[model samples]
Target: MALPTVPHLSQDGIAFSAVKNRPAYAIASVDSALLLASLLQQEGAMRVTDVAARLGVSVSTAHRLLGMLVYRDFAEQLPDRRYAAGPVLRRGPVQQASVARLREVALPHLRGLVEAVGETANVMVLAGPDVRFVATVESDQVLRVGDRTGRTLPAHLSSGGKAVLATLDDERLAAVVASLDAAVAVRLERELRTVRRRGVAVNDQETEAGLTAVGVAVPPSGGVTGAALSVAAPSARYSRDRLPVWKEALAEAAGGIARDLGDG
Candidate 1:
């Protein structure tokens, strides 16, 4: 999840190693409240006693952690006082806390792209063999693509995934594609080739039936990065002829973001 780094932040701005080691720190903390919160994060919603037992802390310490999390909107205590991820935290689409700065940098521009294109716009990053939506701008169309923020789906069926994948050389790209089954790999190859040739990728009913999406890569970083910007519309309203328009708008938006990231 730390694979997608911050955009518009210089290399000196963040220590990549710090982010890579976050999970380890999350596991090693001895602070009772933090320990309680950590356990809840790993094992899902739990009663205060359950969290306390797992962390080997007293109920009072568990309560302290729950209170802190609730105050920070990072955890929610149910009516029964069982705890789960809170609304604000549950809404966190970017798993890499360090890279969340990228979202802040990209929001204004991404919203502008969505407005210009008159279609939904999404930003995503790789999650294993799939792509996870990190941000979205919903379409004004009455019939539109749905929000996929924080949701992961197979890369083979997503225009965004292909767009990002196209930037990789054949060796690395093949390795990424090979993680999937043969059929999925074949489709990825076909789509990625089109993405490479056209500088845009389109998904025509490959994800959900009657839903079409077009995308371009967001080169947030050079060499082996996996971030994409996508536009989606209902298939009933899409046409091959419209692809050129979509490609133009998408390329403009992606190019600007890529430039900003490179300068960083």
Candidate 2:
């Protein structure tokens, strides 16, 4: 008997035909597993019950689907006992290697910055309109800013984001900030000019209360901006007089990474 064709949604949310000629490969269990994986990827960490609720399935079914995902390395149980997207699901094949290279080239420079500034140093890249912390080296101090590796934050609100934003051409910058309100857009346009003038960006407890940071954009020798390097500390410890020192350390680290990546 011929199976009836059914509409399916692709990863890009486009509707497509399924089940007809492909009925042999369209097992319900496999389809459910793929949907579960996609949900986990889109929603970040999710509990079994949460997944079940979202998928309109029984908890047992959600558990089984998650098990399959874990077995295939598409998802993992976080320390909090929730499931989050795993390595294979997060990056494309080429992006995985590119990110590895970025971390390798930035680690030494990040450590050096931490040692020089006595603050947490991070290597961040702009992922679309967001700033993502890819690697971090913490200062030895017991009360320093916490590690932010694998975290994403708004680009306009972070020093690293501002530093990277300063490197964009006017047209690109406008497009990236298009979602901002009129007041914020106007303010950010002015701030970018200042970042260009000072060659650094400062987040003075703007992103989070009681934290401050200094950032510098990594400029490749090829004349293109690559990433941003930043050093962060407690607001109490990050006094105005200390900005220059942190700025110098971050700039040096950024320059070193850029050079290593052939962007110096």
Candidate 3:
């Protein structure tokens, strides 16, 4: 019997068509990813041949596709080398620009975190070695970290940047920090090491005196989804040092968003 096909449903074709057409890494040929995705819907798991038969592609081609899936962690190979959904993924639509998708995936979590911390919560992504605040929800508190809806800050100077960089290997991390002055780069590397250990990044008067922020990197799947969840509070409100609360909240929120993007 023939396996069923993966539906070609476009959740927001008008908006996401451009992105869907472009492969995650800008590499050509998405036939395999689509085929694998189709196979996933038809069955809980699949082997290379199972996909090859349905897509009418050669088994060798299927093998190559499966290997790509393994590289990206979009599908996992069990001991038997059978594939399942690699991990959490951003799904449903593709026409959306990266920024739009980031907002959709992150806004709900950011809002919840803001409500929890009673301060502004933000979604920040690294843009050309700088951390850009793409989305934000201001806190209900009388004081806030700052009004930074679409502002960019030095990745070395912000909590979100540290969190994201901590997840990178030394070489990649160094490239980002190297762009800064020596003192700034050294301080950031030291802090990034601490972030890797503690699983959260803190910018206590580092970004700006009298402003404290906490964040955790959104375990990235590829690049567009690579961002961090952060909470910003006035030094006064954070005076008593609500570090633990924000740390837990940022991690939880980032995790939730990661799941939505298929990174969990």
Candidate 1 has its poorest 10 consecutive residues by lDDT at 13-22
Clash pairs for candidate 2: 220-263, 220-264, 221-263, 221-264
Predicted candidate 1 versus true structure: per-residue lDDT over 1-264, tens digit per residue: 232321112223321111112342343333455544433443357788876776667888777778888898778888886888776555433345323444545566678877887877887776556776666777665455554555556776788877878887778677787778898788678867777888988878776656688988887553325778888876777899889988888888877776766665
Q: How many residue pairs clash in each candidate?
A: 0, 4, 15
Put down candidate 2 lDDT per residue, 1-264, tens digits, no spaces: 221221333333322121112243478777677666655553367899988986678999999899889989999998999998777778621133345467778899998998898878888777778776677787776456655655667788789899989999878888888989899988988998999999999988676656678898887443324478888876777788888888888878877777787732
Instruction: Give the winner by lDDT.
Output: 2
Q: Each model's TM-score, in the order given? A: 0.62, 0.66, 0.60
For model 2, state the Cα shift of residue 186 in Å: 0.8
Residue 39 CA displacement from its true place in model 2, Å: 18
Runs in model 2 lying further than 4 Å from the true structure: 1-94, 221-225
lDDT values, one for every candidate:
0.67, 0.73, 0.66
Which ranges in model 3 have alpha carbons more than 4 Å from their true place?
1-96, 239-241
The global Cα lDDT (0 to 1) of model 2 is 0.73
Q: Quote the positional error of residue 92 for candidate 2 in Å.
A: 7.9
Per-residue CA lDDT of model 3 for 92-178, tens digit only, reads 222225555676788889889987888888887776586766667766543344335445667777888778888887687777777
